[model samples]
Target: MKIHNSRLISALFAIAFGAMQTVSAAAETVRSLDDLAFLEGHWRGGEDFVFEETWNGAEGGVMTGMARGVSSGELKVLEYIVVSAEEDAVVMRFKHFRRDFSTWEDGGPIILMLTDAKENDVTFSADPPSETVKSIRYFKTGENTLQADIVLVEDGEEGGFTLVFDRAD
Candidate 1:
């Protein structure tokens, strides 16, 4: 009788574990749009990047165009980023898009944490094993401008530049 009771207790414990996992996952579901609704306008900015190397001439430059949020399935702004083109498997995603059929996938960065509304900021770690490049993007609202600042961190240390933007209008 003791052996039978022990087996019954084990079965009950397994069932409880499965139920707890489901509840935890639902808690992590989309609670509100507070996470991504801040970035919703046109912005213009100049982007510049520098590289370190043993050789004398191996840096890069770009003319940046930026566009923010969308509605009714459209590209609403002119802002831009050339990051994914140079790197492999880097992608972007919004809450609306689906992974099974969307070309712009959510593979770029994890939205690690968020601040209050009307502020745009993100922490991104690109290619976890590669300590060569990782960064944070911080954007904020202004009187007559909308701004985004990009700061890169390498191997747990912070380096790179900040980009301040003006409203494109």
Candidate 2:
């Protein structure tokens, strides 16, 4: 009788542990930009996509920010217009809002698949193709020069143009 009781308790404990692990793994599977350590830095770039920006040739801007996790960490992308020295300060720089097939993309809410980060590059990809590139590569050219290229296609054009962001210091 003692042996049987011990075996039954052991089985129950094992089942409970399995359930706990399932929940933990599920949480990890859904990735947010805040989970990316490489994205922790401050990055400034331009938005020059003709289809997405009316002032595409002018000065478009991009800003990514992260915050501490409460229930879950949150990451947000802000798009605004960087006015020239002779313009107003209320210019918007970010996109991902409209749906005229010529606006910014909706926030890429996805779970990260893999993080193949390196000393000079950090690749981030998501599930179901929410963002342009599954993985964003940050390649360093010099002390103050880096290039980030991501491909964006509207309405499923495989040979679409690449949204290139160049950093000039």
Candidate 3:
């Protein structure tokens, strides 16, 4: 291989500038829990079954929440959720529980890390790629309307459901 001096310098400069751009872009997406204050309120949505979620204001860099589903006037599913601002990234962990307090996620709470954030949207992806959920996204469609998309994966296939909620509080 013949390498010209000018070509070598050009390649080196390209690599250096590319690395800087990558780093700068990544830094722009970093978020803190305070950025998610919109989630602190009551939300209700669902068709066949009524589902409700409530999130508390972020305190000490953490927000705690819970969700439950009711069908036929009977409580069906319950979930405990926590979103925290870590040193490097914001993280969300949630666990589902049955009416009897039995867990649906036998392994452990599903863990997701903040991957993207926009003016009124935030997305968290499975940290290590869980079997049940691949990612979850929350975005505001209107001032009092919010939508949540829960992405799921099974058997190497991708599927998801979206929930549209109105401000309940």
Candidate 4:
């Protein structure tokens, strides 16, 4: 009886561990910027403010882009962004600037390394980690619409906004 019980317990543990490993493996698929080529174009939209972003097509393992936000006919914020392939991971970096071209990040650009990805959705996290902002995710909803979600990881808080861009070419 003791031998039977021990065998049963070990079998259950093995099954449970295997299930966990399967889930983890599915959640860590690597993605490339070429999979996100649909994002290449001039996109503009905002609810209370006007926002615009222009992205060049992926080439040579890198994509370059710029974003701007305006309110009441006044420039509010600007960002220079880049996405590049680094070894086996995709990396995103952004630097914020004011209307006068003054940088917002005194230390340097914010870096986000790819964590998970699928057909139209990809997630990235700050490489060295941050208290205020931790992750950013982009999901394509339609042929020309994209949604961006920014995660504030300190307390697990999240906030996001959507942008729709028409093909400018």
Candidate with top TM-score is: 3
Model 1 lDDT per residue over 19-38, tens place: 99998876564223333333
Question: What digit string (tens of lDDT, one per residue) describes model 4 on residues 1-169?
Answer: 9999999999999999999999888646657887667677888877678888888988898999899998999999999999998777888889989988999888878888878777878788986576556888777878777777777654655554445555455
- Scored by lDDT, the top model is 3
Candidate 4, residue 117: Cα displacement in angstroms equals: 1.7
Q: lDDT of each structure?
A: 0.40, 0.39, 0.90, 0.80
The C-alpha local distance difference test score for the whole of candidate 3 amounts to: 0.90
Q: Model 2: per-residue lDDT, tens digit, 38-66?
A: 33343344333211111222223222332
TM accuracy, model 2: 0.38
Candidate 4 worst ten-residue window by lDDT: 160-169
lDDT-superior candidate, 1 or 2: 1
Report the number of backbone clashes for model 2.
11
Off by over 4 Å in 2: 23-127, 130-144, 160-167
* Count of residue pairs whose backbone atoms collide, per candidate: 6, 11, 0, 0
